[model samples]
Target: MATKKKPSSDQGSSSSALDSSRWEVSCFWERRLQKELMSLMKEPPPGVTVDAEGAGQNLTQWIIQMDGAQGTLYEGEQFQLQFKFSPKYPFDSPEVTFIGPNIPVHPHVYSNGHICLSILTEDWSPALSVQSVCLSIVSMLSSCKEKKRPPDNSFYVKTCNKNPKKTKWWYHDDSV
Candidate 1:
């Protein structure tokens, strides 16, 4: 059973107070994701577009469309990014991965669509938004001078968890 109440009035709900603990978690992330989605649609970052329809129906999952930046090794290529948010997002980071038929051949992106970006893992911050993440991904791709998979992409993909966020990412100072 579920009851609906304004987030501002969460504490005032007639429902069990014990449920408030769980309610608050969803409220926090829901509010943050709504704002982030609105801002992304209104003023999306360079070479990026949002799948507004997918977001409207399901706040937990989003499909982001990105165009490879000009002059980059992936120039003129297209890619889709899938962002899956947990109830503790903002405090935690979303599970982001490349999802379409045209996944880019980047050293950080495995053939299984998992990305090895630090912000998506150990270095995530509550201050970061979808726009900033998109920009970071764009920057990563734009700065790349060649198209190649990570040195350990095969081994990692073969034995890694389906959820990219679950893996302990080991970023090196020498990586792209």
Candidate 2:
């Protein structure tokens, strides 16, 4: 027997807010993302580069390029991460995933591009920023010893939620 999870009161209200003022809310987040993008362009972190995808008119989605850090199993390898931000950003974490043809095979990373990192889910805080998330991901890659998938890779990839942010991930392993 399985138990059903209850939706939080906050979720309900946020959904209502979205339904009521969808355009206004999206504009607010877009401006915020634009500001962050400008700041990032001025001073980006090492081994990480970000740009708006498509015609650069939308700030809601971005493409991030990351180079594997030295001394890691993925050294010299490059990867692309796609981040999709919702109108409730800062309050809601972005949907981040490895994109393109070269996805890294890491224990916490799914073949479908979903990453099981805690910060992107349960551990997410409104205080966390895009820059911080990039740093965290780079650090995760840096600490990995072996290039491989999680123990339940095949199963998880087959049945995992399309939106990783909706999944309830178990993050017991912190060894990376």
Best by lDDT: 1
Candidate 2, run of 10 with poorest lDDT: 5-14
Cα displacement (angstroms), candidate 1, residue 126, comes to 0.5
Clashing pairs in 1: none
Best by TM-score: 1
| Tens-digit lDDT track of model 1 for 17-74 | 4344555533767766877888899899989999988896898999999999988888
Model 2 TM-score relative to the real fold: 0.81
lDDT of each residue in 5-34, candidate 2, tens digit only: 333333222334545543443245554565
Q: Candidate 2: global Cα-lDDT?
A: 0.78
- Residue 19's lDDT within candidate 1 is 42
Clashes of 2: 0
